[model samples]
Target chain A: MSRSFSTSERRVLGALHYLGFGLFLAACTAGFVRTWVLFGNPPSIDPLASHRQYIQLLDRKQDYESAVDRIEIAQQLAPYTAAVDGLSIQGYGQIGLGLLERGHPSTARLYLQRLFLALEQTTELPSDDAEMLDMLARILDRSYELGTGAEAILKDSLLLSLLNNLAWIRATHRSDSIRNAEQALRFASRAADMTKREDPSLLDTLAAAYAEAGRWQEARQTERLAVAQAERAGVADVAISSMKQRLSLYEDRLPYRE
Target chain B: MSQADASHFSVTRLTGRSFIHPLFDYLVIGGGISLIATIVIWQSGRSDIVPMAVVPLILLLSNSAHFAASTVRLYTKRGSFEALPFLTMAFPCVCLLLIALCLAWPLRLGMNLQSLYLTWSPYHYAAQAYGLAVMYAYRSGCLLTTSDKRLLFWCAMIPFLRMFFCIQDTVLGADIGLAWIAPSSLYRLFEPYQAGLDRMLLIAACAAPLVLLIKTWRSSSGAIPMISLLMLVTNTVWFFALEPINAFVWATVFHGLQYLAIVVIFHVRDRLSEPTNRHGKLYHALWFYGWCVLLAYALFFCLPQAYQMLGFGVDESVWVVIAAINVHHFIVDGYIWRLKKGDSNRQVVDSSAPAAAPRVSSPAGL
Candidate 1:
C-alpha cells in the first residue's frame, strides 16, 4: 500500500520538514530571550512572586482557596523567608476569615493543618503588622476554638500578637461574660514579656488588663509607661494621643471598653 | 432480516485482535471498564471523589513510559530516518535543548511550557481516542464512510471542546507554579454569557455520543462496532462524567495503560517480524515494557533527583520536566503514529486476528 513519492514531491516535503524544524527551534529560542529581556526572571514557576502579584486580586474575588494554595506554594518554594511568612499571615488570615464567613470553618482548619505539616517549620513564622492585627486576632480565635493546631506553627511575633489581641478583647469587651480580667492579665503579661515590654501597644494592652483587674495604681503606672513608650518609639501622633487618653481613663479607675 | 439472526450475524462479523488481548484491552486500555463495564459506567453517576496520592504514583508509572513509547517507536521503526529525518535526529536535540532552557528559567518559560502541556493534555487524549476508534473499526472490517467518521470525530472531540470552554477552570485551577492568575479580561468580558455557554457545552458533551450512536446505527443500517462505541463513551465519561480533578486522575491512569498496551504490542510485533531476530513475542514484549518502565524511572525519578543535586527544587524539577516530556510526547506521537505518509502502522490497521478477511474494501488505506 506504500505510494512512491515523486522526486519533486519528496524534495518539497524535505524542505517543509527542515523549514518547520528551523522555525520551531528559532521560535523557542526567541521566546526564551524575549522573556528574559521583558521579565528578567519570569515569575512562571516562582510561587513567591506570583503570590505577591495576585494576593490583592485574589482577595478581591474572595478566592480564598486559591489564595491559600498560592501561599502554600510560595511557602514551599521559599520556606522560612520573611516574605513567605508575610504572604502566609496575610493570606491565611484572609482565607481563614473568608472560609468562616462562607461557613467552611472545618475546611479552613484543614487548610491550616496542611500548610504547616511539621511544627519545626514554624521557627520563623510571620510576625504581625498593625494592619493585620484584626485579621490575625479573628483567625487565632477561630484556631483556638476549632483546635486547628494553628498555634503550634506560630512565629514568636504572631504568637505575641495573638496573646495581646486575646487579652485586649477579654479586658475591654463590653459583655461581662466575655471579659476575664484574671486570664487577660496573664495573657497580657506573657505578650509584654515576649516583646520585652518594648511594643507600646502591648504596654497599652497591659494597662487595660490592669484596670480590668481593678488595680488602679498599677493601671495608671502602666498607662503612663505606654504613653511614654509610644512617644519614645516615634509612634504615630494619633496612637500617642490615644495612649494619653487611656492614661486619664486609668486615673479614673475605669477600664477600657472596645 | 430476523431480529435475533441479524443480531447474531452482527456479533459474528465483529472479530479482530481485540486491539490486543480481549480482557486487557477491554478492562485497562479501554479505561477502567471491561467490555460490559463501559456500558455500565456510562449510565452510572459521575464520581465526585479525587485520589490525591495515587495520581503521582500513576504518572510516575504510566505517563513516563507511555510518553517515551512514541519516541522509541519513531527512532526504531523501519525507514523512520529516511521518512522523518528531522524528527528522528535533530528533534531529540531540540527537545533536550528546550528542556534545558525550561530547567534554567523555570519561572517564565518553564511555567508557560508547563501550562501548555496541561492545556494540551486533554486535547491529546481526545485525539488519541479518535485515533483508536478508527483503528479498531478498520481492524474489525467496518467500512465507515466519511460521514460516519465525521460523526465519530465530533463525538470523540466533545471532551476537548468542553475543556476548551473552561481551560483555566478545568486544567490549572491555581495548580500551576503557585499563581492564582486572573482570567483574562476577555474571559471576564464573556462572563455574562458564560453560564449559558457552560450549560450548552456540558449538555453537548454528554449527548453528542448517544446521538452519534443512533445516527450511525440508522445511517449505516448496522450497529457501530461495540469497541468503537466503548471508546467514545469511555473517553467522554473520563472527561465529563467525573469531576475535573477526578477525571484527570482516571484519564491519566487509563490513558497511560491504553498507550502502553498499544505501543508495546506494536513494538513486539515489529521485533518479531524481523527476519534475523531470535526473540519470541513474550521476550520482546517484556523487553520493550521493562525498558519503558526503567526509562520512565530514569526520566521522572532519577533525572529530577540529578537536577535537584544540580540545585533545583524537587517539585520544580519534577513538575517542569514532566510537563516538558508531555509536550515532546504529544508532538512526536503525531509524527510516529500517523496512518498516512507511507506509515499505515500495519501493526494496527492490519491488526485483525489471523485468518480473518475484511467484510468490504481493504483497511490498509484507513
Candidate 2:
C-alpha cells in the first residue's frame, strides 16, 4: 500500500520544513524585540490613535463605506473614548451631509440616522448649549425637508431649539409642500412653553406661526413683545432689527417667508 | 482496490512529481509556510506596518477570497451541487437575508450576529487544523488508529477551549445575543475559574502532543509525520501567543492562505484527472485559478455595492453577507473534505488512480 517519495523529494521536504521553522522563530523573535523597543508594552494598544489614523485615511480617500466599517471596529476597541465617539459622530455626519448634497436622500437618511444615534450616545456634549442645539436643529430641519424620514426624528427631539426651528420651518419655508401653519403653531407654542416664554427665539417662532395662520393681531402683539424683550435683554442689534421687521410685516397683515 | 487498501495506499503515498512537487505540496498547501507567515505578522512590533497594511489584506483575503471562495466552489461545480442539496444551500442564504432585513430595526441583531461569528471562528480554525493534521498523517504514511485521531482532535481543541473561556468577559460576553449560546449566568459563574482553566488547558495542550508523539512512535514504528506535529504546534501558537484580535487576524490570514492553496490545488487536480479534457496542464490550472479570483472579487466587493444600490445599508449588507458566507463555509467544509467520501476527495487525494477527464467546461478563453 505504500507509495514512496523519491529521495530528492524527501530531502527537499525536510529542508523546507526546517527552513519554515527557522523563519518562524526568527521572525517572531525579531518582531517581539522590535515591538518592545518601539511600543514599550506589547499589550498596551492605543485604539484611540489607531481609530484616528483609520478615520483620517478614510477621510482622505472619501471611502465612506470603509470609514463606517473602521469606525465600528474603533468603537469596539475603545467603546468609552470621548475622542473616538466624537470622531464616529463627525464621520457619520460628514458622510450623511455628503450624501444629502449628492441628492441621495434615502441613503443619506441612513447615515444621518446613525449620526444622530452616535450623538445621542456621547456624554461630552453639553445638553444646554443653545448654539449647538440650534445647529443640530438646523441640520435636522434640512434633513426633514429632503424627504429623509426625519420628521419623526424632529418630532421626537425634546430640545427647545430643535422644536423652535421646526416651528420656524413650518411657518416660513418657501415650499408650500413643507409649510404647515397648524403644526407650526403647536410646535412654537410647545417650544415657548418649554422656555417658560422667556427665550426671545421661541417668542419669535410663535410670532411667525401666528402670522402664518393669518392671526395678524396676535402676530403683531407677539413680535412687539419679542422685540421689546430682545432690547431689554441686550440682544444683538441685528436680531432686534429682524424682529422689528417681522413686527412690521405682521402689522401689515403679511406672513413672513424665507 | 478495497476501501482498506485504498485508504492504506492513499495514506502511504506522496503526491506525484507530475501533478505537484511533493515538497511544495507538503510545505505550502499543507500549512507550513502559512504557519511561519502567521507568526511573523502576529509577533511583529512594527505596528505601523502590520495593522496598517497586513491586517486589511489578511481580512480581505481571509473572508472574501478564502471564505466566500468556498461558496463559489459549491455553486460552480456540479459535484458540489450534488454534495450540497439546493434547499440546504438556500436555507442559509434566506436566513442571512432575513438577518440583514432585521438589521434595519433597533434590536442589536447585527452585534449579535458578529458575536456568533467571532465565537464560532476559533472552533472552526481548530477543527481545520485537526483535519489537516489527520490529512498530512494519512498522506505521510501514518495509519492513525481511531484512538490517535481522538487524541489529536482533543489536543487541537484544547487551545480553542482555552480561548473560549478566556473570551467570556471580553468581546463575546457583552455582544453575544443568544442567551442559550453564551448564557450570562455561565459567564458569571465561570468568572473566577477562567484563569485557572486557561492555565490547565494550556498545560494539557502542551503535554498532549508529547503524549501523541510517544504513542505514535510506539504504534507506527516512528512513522509519525513532522507535518502533523507541526500542525498542532501551529494551532497552539495561533491561540496562545497573540491577543484575541491579533490571533483572529493571524489565524484568519494563515488559514485562508492554507484553504485557498488547497482548494485551488484540489480544483486543478480534479480537472487534470479527467480523461476527456484536451487542455494542457497550464490551461487547466490557470482556468481554475482565474475563475476563483474573479468569483471571489464579485462576491466580496461587487455584491456589497450592488446591495447598497438596491437600498440596503453598505455596512449592514456587507457584514451580513460576510457572516453568512462564514457560517456557510463552516457547514459546507464539515462534510465536503471527508476523505471517506467517494467523489471530490478521491479526485483530489488519490493521485495513484487513473486521472479522470475534465468534466466541467472552461471559461471562454481557456
Candidate 3:
C-alpha cells in the first residue's frame, strides 16, 4: 500500500535531507571557529580583564572548577597586580561561599584558603585601604570557623573583628573537637586589650571564652559588664537581653555553645 | 463513516505499517500517559535517580538531534533555498553571532538578546504543540471546519498567553540579564492583571479540549483522535503542573522526543520510497536513529569541549550555540510544515479528492 513518488520528488526530498546535514556541519564548524578565534586568546592589553570576564562567566554557570582554574591563570599572568589579585580573591570567595552553602565544608575550606593565599600575595595594596584588608581577614577567619584548614599560618596583623570572630568560634564552636578554650582566651584578651574593653561585643567574646575555660565567676562578671556597656552604648535591647541570658548561663556554670 | 473508513484516518494510515504500531502511537503521540508517568516518577522521591541518569541523554537528543532535524526540511531541498532566499538565512545567523559576540564582549545588549530568547521560547513550544495537534487531527481524519481550526489554534495559544501575561515575570524578571531589558513600567502595568489573566487562561486552556471534543461529536462523521485531545491536555500539564524550571526541563525533553519521533518517521518513510541507487545505501530505521544520536553527541557534547580546549569560554560558547540553534529552529519550523498541495502534503496526509483511494496498508501487513 506504499504510495509511489515521482523520481523528481524523491530527488527533492533527498536533497533536502542532505542540505540539512550540510547546514548542521557548516553551522557547527563556523560556530567552533568563531568562538575559538573570538574568545580563545587573552586580550593584548588587558589579559587580566579578559580572564576576569571568563571567570565571571564560569561563576555564573556554576562551574567552580573552571573558575578556579581561570583564577590561577589570572594570578600567574599578572602575579601581584591589584586588579588580578582582587579578581582572584572575589572568584575564589564566590566558589568557596557557594560550596559552603551547598554543604561541602571541606571543599569550601580549600577555596577559602586559596582566597587567603591570594590576598596575602597582594603586598602592594594601598596602605590607606585598611578596610579592604580588614574585610578579607574577617572573611578568612569566618571560613576557618566553618571548617578546618589554614589555621597554622595566621595573618601577622589581625584586625579586631577577626580576633573577635576567632575568639567567638573557639569559645562556642558546637563541636568539642573544634573548640579551643586556651586559644579563645588568648584571642579574647588581646581583642579586649586592643579595644580597651570599650566594645561590648568584645567583652561578650571574653565572657564566652571565660565560660569555655570553666572560670564561672570571671565569666559571670564579664557578662554583667558586657550587658551594662551594651545598654550604655545604646545597643539593641534584644542584645542586652541576650547578654543577660549568657550571664545567667555563666552563673549556673554552664558554657555557651554556638 | 464506517469503521473501515475511520481506520483509514489513523496514524497507521500516514506512516507505513512497518513504522507505526498502536502501542508506539499511543506512547509517542497520545502523550497524556507519558506526562502522567513522568510526573509520578518525578514526584516519587526516587525521581532524582532517573532524571539525573536520563536527563543528560535526553538533552543531547532534544537540544541537538531534534533541533538539527528541522534543517532537513528547511535548507536541504532545492526549493527551500529559493523560497527562503539567501539574505533571509544569513540575517538570523549574523544576528545570533552578533548577540554571541556581545555576550562575550560583556555588553548590555547581550542581556537583551537573552531576555528576548527566554520570552520567545514558550511561544515556540506552544506553536509546535499546535502544529502537532493539527497534524494529528488531519491524520486521524478530523475534518476541522474553519471555526474548529481557529478554536484549536487558540487552545494551543492559551498556555503561551498565560505564560506571557502572568508567569513571565517570575521566571525572567529575577534574571539580571532579563531585568536589564524588562522595563519597570511594563511590570507595573501587568502586575495587577497577572492573577486574573492567569486564572482565566488556566480555565480556558483546560476547557478548550472539551469544547473540541464536543465539536467533534457534533460534526456527525468527524471523530476526534485521542492523540489530538491528549496533545492539548499535555500542553496544559507542561505549563501548569510543574514549577517553571522543572516544567522547562521535562517539557523540553518530552517535546524533543515527540519531534524526534515524528521527524524520524518522516525521514524513514521518505527515504524508503526514494530510489536506493541515488540515495546510496538504504538505511534501516535503527541505523538512521544511530546516526542522529552520533550527530547529537558531536554537536552538543564534543563541540563544546573542543571550544573549551581552544580557550573559548566553554559555558558561554555552549549557551550561545544552543541559543543560536533554537532561534534557527523556530524560524525554520514556521514554514516547513505548511500543508501545501504537492508531494509534501500528500506524503503526510490522505488526499481529499474523491478519485484518490487510500493506498496505505493495514498494520498487520508489515
Computed on C-alpha atoms, the DockQ of candidate 3 is 0.06
lDDT of each: 0.63, 0.60, 0.60
Off by over 4 Å in 2: A1-258, B1-19, B38-43, B46-48, B51-58, B87-96, B105-107, B168-180, B352-366
**lDDT of model 2 at residue B125?**
77
Docking class of 1: incorrect
Q: DockQ of all candidates, in order?
A: 0.05, 0.02, 0.06
- Candidate 1 residue-wise lDDT, B108-208, digit = tens: 76677866776677778887777777667666555566777777777877787666655444234222211224456656675577568667877887787
Candidate 2, residue A256: lDDT = 93
Candidate 3's residue-wise lDDT over A99-209, tens digit each?
Answer: 555554554566666666665566443223333434344445555576443343345343465577667877887877667788789878978987788889999999999
What is the per-residue lDDT of model 2 for residues A157-202, given as tens digits with 9 covering 90 to 100? Answer: 4346557766887788776766779878977997788677777878
Which scores better on lDDT, 1 or 3?
1
- Return the top candidate by lDDT: 1
